[model samples]
Target: MAMPPNSVVPTTEHTTTTTTTSSKPMEVPVKPHHDARSPSFLRLGLYPITLKFEDVVYKVKIEGKGTCCGGEVSMKEKTILNGVTGKVSPGELLAMLGPSGSGKTTLLTALGGRLKGKLSGKITYNSRPFCGSMKRRTGFVTQDDVLYAHLTVTETLLFTAMLRLPNSISQDEKVEHVEQVIAELGLTRCKNSMIGGPLFRGISGGEKKRVSIGQEMLINPSLLLLDEPTSGLDSTTAQRILTTIKRLASGGRTVVTTIHQPSSRLYHMFDKLVLLSEGSPIYYGPASTALEYFSSVGYGTSITVNPADLLLDLANGIAPDVMQEHEQGETTEKDQKLVRQKLHTAYETNISTRLKADLCGLDVSNHINQAKEVATRNHVSSEQWCTSWCHQFHVLLLRGVRERRFEPFNRLRIFQVISVAILGGLLWWHTPTSHIEDRVAMIFFFSVFWGFYPLYNAVFTFPQERRMLIKERSSGMYRLSSYFLARTIGDLPLELALPTAFTFILYWMGGLKADPATFVLSLLVVLYNVLVAQSLGLAIGAILMDVKQATTLASVTTLVFLIAGGYYVKQIPPFIVWLKYLSYSYYCYKLLLGVQYNENDLYECSKGVHCHVVDFPAVKSVGLTNLTVDLLIMAMMLVGYRLVAYMALQKVQ
Candidate 1:
C-alpha cells in the first residue's frame, strides 16, 4: 500500500482538551511510571524497530548564586528545561513553544538525535536510540542557515536533491520536484541567484527560511523539526510562516518548532503550545485552553496582552494581583500555593498523557525495516561496487564541472598560459650561456613556480565551498566522498591546463636539445607534480577548515616543497635529507634531469666547464624510464591524500 503524505495513518480515535479550576484548587496525586527495559544488542544488532520516548525528562543545569547567600561561585546548575515531553508522529506539525532560553532549541537537537547531554528517559526510534536507522530517516533544520554562499539557489537545492533523491526518479522529475519546492518556499525570483556574500545575493530572510525548510523536505522526512522558524523576521512574515506551518501540519506532516514571542494573531495557529520556565513545564495543551488554564487559577485574561507574555509572567512568577488579593483576604497565600500545586499536577496528568498518546503516531520502525528490506532484496553485489561508485561520483562531478564553467576564474587559466608563453619567449632570446646544468636549473625553477598559482587556487577554493557543503551534508543530501571526488576530478583539467601550456612554451623556447620523447616525459612529470600539489591543497583545506589558515599553510608548504625538493641545494643534512625524499620537488627534479640530461653532462658539470656540444654527454634510457616511475609515485601520493580526506569526512557527524 502507498504511504500517506507525511505518513499520517487515519484513525477515528480522538482526544479532548482538559480543564481545571482553582479557588484553592485540588492537587492530583502523582504516580511513578515503570521503566522500559533495555534491549539486547547481540540478538538484534540490525533488527528494525521504531524509536519511542515515553515520560521523557531532560534537564539543563544553570549556574548562579543568591545575592543574600555566599558571594562565591556556586556550582549550581539550574535546570533550563525539565519534564519536557512530546512525540513527532508522521504527517504532523508539532510546535514546541517557549520564551528565550527555555531550552527549545536544545530539545529540537535532542529529537534529531544529535544533542550532547545526559538524557534521563527512554528514547527509542527503530528500536535504537540515536545512532540507529531512525537518524537516516529524519531530516533536521537548524536555527542557522548553513548554505553555500556561492552556489545559486537552484544549484544548491538541485545538487542536494540529486544526492538525496533515489535514482528511481528521472532527471526531469527531480528537477520538477526541486522547482516545486522552491516555488512553495517562494524562492522563484531568486531561483538562479547565487547563495554567497555581498557579491552573491538572493532570496529574502523569510524565503531563505522556507528554502531551508525545503532542503530538509527534499529528503521527504515523515516528521519535520524547525528551530525558531520565524526568527529575525517581521511580524507579517512570521505570520505567513506560521500559516504555512499550520497548512503543513493539516496536510499530514508533523511540524515541531521552538518559537520565541510569536504574535498573538499567530498564536491561534499552533495545534499544541508547550510552556516552559526555569526548566519546568508550566503548561502544555491547545492554544485556546492556554488563556483559560491561566485564568482559572486567578490569572484571568488580561486586556490587550500578548499571550506569550502572559505565559512568561505566570511561569517566572505571579504578579501583584496575587498579593493584592491575599491582602484583601479574597485569596490567602496558602490558596496561591495550592493553585500552583494543582496546575503542576494537572500538567503532569493531562499534558504528559496526551504527548505519550501522540508518540504512537511515529513509525520509525517501519521505515527502518523498509530500508533493510530494500538493501537485502537488491543485494548490491561486489561487482556492482564500481557501478555504484561511478553513479555516486558522477552526480557531484557534473555539478563541479558546471560550477567551474561559470566560475569567475575560468578565463584566468588561459591568461596564465598566455603569460607563460610570452615570458618564456622573452627568456629564449637571452638563452643562458652557462653549462647544461644551468639550463636544467632554469627549467626546474620555472616549472615549480608555475605550479604555485593552481595550488593556491585549489587551497582557497575548498574553504569557500565548505560552507556550502556543510549545509548540504547536514541535510543528508549526498555522501561527503561525492563532494571531494567531484571537486578533485572536475578541477583536474583546469589544474593541468595552465601547467601543461607552460611546459610547452618553456620547453620549445629554452631549446633543451632533447628528443621529443624526453620533452613529453618531462612535461608529464611536471603535470603530475601539479596534481600532487592540488591534493596537498585539499588535505590542508580539510584539516584547517578555515580560509586564512589553509591559504597560509598552502603557501608555506608549497615553498618548503619547492626548496627542499632538491633543485637548489646539492646536499641536505643527514637529518633533513629525508625531507628530499618526502618532497614532490625532489621527484620532479630528479626525473626531469634523468630525462633531459645525459650522465656525461653531469660529469662535465662536476668538471666545472660549460658544454654545449651535441651528445657531449650521451643520454641514457634509464632517465626516460624514471619519468614513468616518478609520475606513478606522485599519482600514488595524490590518491593517498584523497583517501585520507574521504575517511575524515565520513566521521564529521
Candidate 2:
C-alpha cells in the first residue's frame, strides 16, 4: 500500500542506538512507534510542512530615558534567541520546554513569521525559504483565546472558514469543513453556545481552547504553531488538548508548541523536545530519550519525579544540588552558574552529534521538490488568498453586526439616547414660534448632543479591536480596505437607529415643525452628523491605540467644534470665522434650522397679532441661507472624515 504524504507507517520492532563517551557507553532509549520511520513524500491533497532552523539569532533594542543634562539616552541590545537550531518533520509534535523568559515563546513567534527584530539565520519550510506563502500554510494559535465573545461556536468557525478558506472551495464545502472541524474537536455539544467572556458565562476554558484550535484548523494548514496551548488549563484539559494535537500530527502534518512545566503524562505525548535556557539550547532530541541522555550525564532524577520538572529545574539552575546548598546557605550565584555550565557542556559533547545526524537524515530538499511539483500539478500556489474581497467584506459585515448587537455597551447606548431625547424634549417642551431664544437653545442642544454621543461611542472602535485586527491583517487573511469598508458599512444600522429615535422624539415633542418633508430632512441631517462624528472618532482611535488618550483627544476636538458651530457667538471675528466651515455641527445645525423655518415661513405672535418678524433670523446669522449647500457640505464632511479614518488605519498598520 502507498503511504500518505508525510505519514509514518510503524513496524513491529524498533532498534535502539547508543553514544560512546570517555567514561562509558550509554544506552539510548528505544524509539517510540510513532517516530520509528520518516514520512514519505506523496501527494495526499495536503501540503505537509517540514520546518527547519539553524543558528537563528534575534536581537532587540531597549531605549531608556535621557540623563539630567540632556545627554544621549542609554541604549542596550538584548538577545532573545541565540544559536537556536532544530528541525521538525511532518508527523512529529515538537515541544519547546523552558522556564519563564527562556525564549520559548520568542522562538515560536519567529518560526511563525510574526516576529520583528534583528534576526539572522536560516528558516525554511520543506527546504524552501519561508515566505508569505508559507505563512498561509501555517496556523498560529496564540497564548490567549482572543475570540468574539458574542458569536456562537458554529458562527465563529464559519466566519473563519469564510475568510481563511480558498475561494475555489464552495460555500457548501466551507460549511462542511466547519462542521467537520467542530466534530473533530468534539465541540458538537456546544456548537450553538456563545464563547462568552468576563460579563457572560458560556463555554468552559477547555472548550474555548478547543474552539481556538478549531478556528485555525478550518483552513487545514500544514504546520501548526501554538504558544502555551496548555498554559491555564488543568492537567486533564491540557492532556486532552495535547492528545488532539498529537492526533493532528498523525494525520500527516507538523505540530510545534511551547509548554511550561507539563505533567509526565503530558510530556510523554510529544514526539520530540527542545530544552532551552536563557535563549540557548541545552538539549534537542527525541522526547523518550531525554531522560536517558540526562541520566547518562549524571543528572538523573528519582523515578517518581516527572522528567519534565527535572529538565526545567536543571535548565533554570535550580537542580537538587543547587537547591539543597541554597537551603543550607552554602550556595552562591557562581555555584548555580557552574551547574548550568556542566549540563550545557555535556549535551554539546555527547548528544549534539547524534541530534545533528538525525536532523541531517530529514531529506528536506526532497520534500521541497515534491511539494513544488505537486502544487504545480494542481495549479495552485500556497500563497493564493483564501477569500475574495467581496467574500471578506461579507464575512466581516456579519461578524461586526453580531458583535455590535450583543455588546452590552450598545444596548446601554440606545437606552441613554432615548433618555436624553426625552429629557431634552421636556426641558424645551412645546415652545411658541415667538420664543426665538428657546428655538435657538433647542437647535444648539440637538447639535451638541448628537455630536458628543456618537464621538464618545466611536472612540472605542479601533482601540478595542486593535490586537485582533493586527493579527488577522498580519496573516494576510484580507486587505485593510475590505475590513475598513465592511466595518463602516456594518455599523450603519445601529448608528442610524438611535439618532433616528432621538430626532423623531425631539422633533415632534419640542414642536419644531409639523411638515413631513422637514421631519425627514431633519432626520437625514442628524444621521449624517452622527456618521461624521463617528468617523473622526475612528480616526482618533486608530491614530492612538489607547482608549484614554483617544477619549481625551475626542473631547477636546468636540469642544472646539461646538464653540465654532455658530451657536454661542453669532457674529464671529474674521480670524476665527473660518473655523465654522470645518465644523460638522455648524452645517448640521444650519440645515436643521433651514428645514424648520423656510424662506416663506412666518413667526407671528400668538395673541391674534401679526408681528413684523416674518421668520427667525437663525438662518442668516450664521451665514447659511441655502439648505442644499448646507446638506451637501454635511455629506462631504461625512466622506472626508471616513477617508481620513481609512488612511489613518492603513498608516498605523
Model number with the top lDDT: 2
Which candidate has the top score in TM-score?
2
Per-residue lDDT tens digits for candidate 2, residues 1-653, read: 11345453222232333422222111111212232122211212457678888888999899977898979899889888988889987788999999999999999998998887699988888877778778777889989988887777877888887788777766666666666666677776677677788987888899999998998877667889998999899999998899888887777678899999999999988889999988888889888898888878887766567889888988877666455666787877787688789987887787667666766776767677667765675455655575778888988997888766667777788889899899988988898787766987798778888887888888888888887887788667888989998987887788889989998998888988778987897887788789888888888888888999999998888888888887777778999889888888888788777666655655555666654332345555664477678778877877877788788787654
Segments of candidate 2 deviating more than 4 angstroms: 1-4, 8-44, 296-298, 301-304, 327-330, 342-362, 373-379, 571-579, 598-621, 626-636, 651-653
RMSD of 1: 13.4
RMSD per prediction, one decimal?
Answer: 13.4, 9.9
Error of 2 at 83 (Å): 1.4
lDDT of each: 0.62, 0.78
Query: How do the residues 494-602 of candidate 1 rate in per-residue lDDT, one tens digit apiece?
Result: 6777777877777777776557898888777788778777777777777677779988887788777777765566556778877766677667666776666544443
Model 1 alpha-carbon drift over 4 Å, by segment:
1-83, 88-91, 99-101, 116-120, 125-137, 148-156, 186-197, 278-280, 295-301, 312-388, 412-421, 424-430, 433-438, 602-632
lDDT of 1: 0.62
For model 1, the run of ten residues with the poorest summed lDDT: 35-44
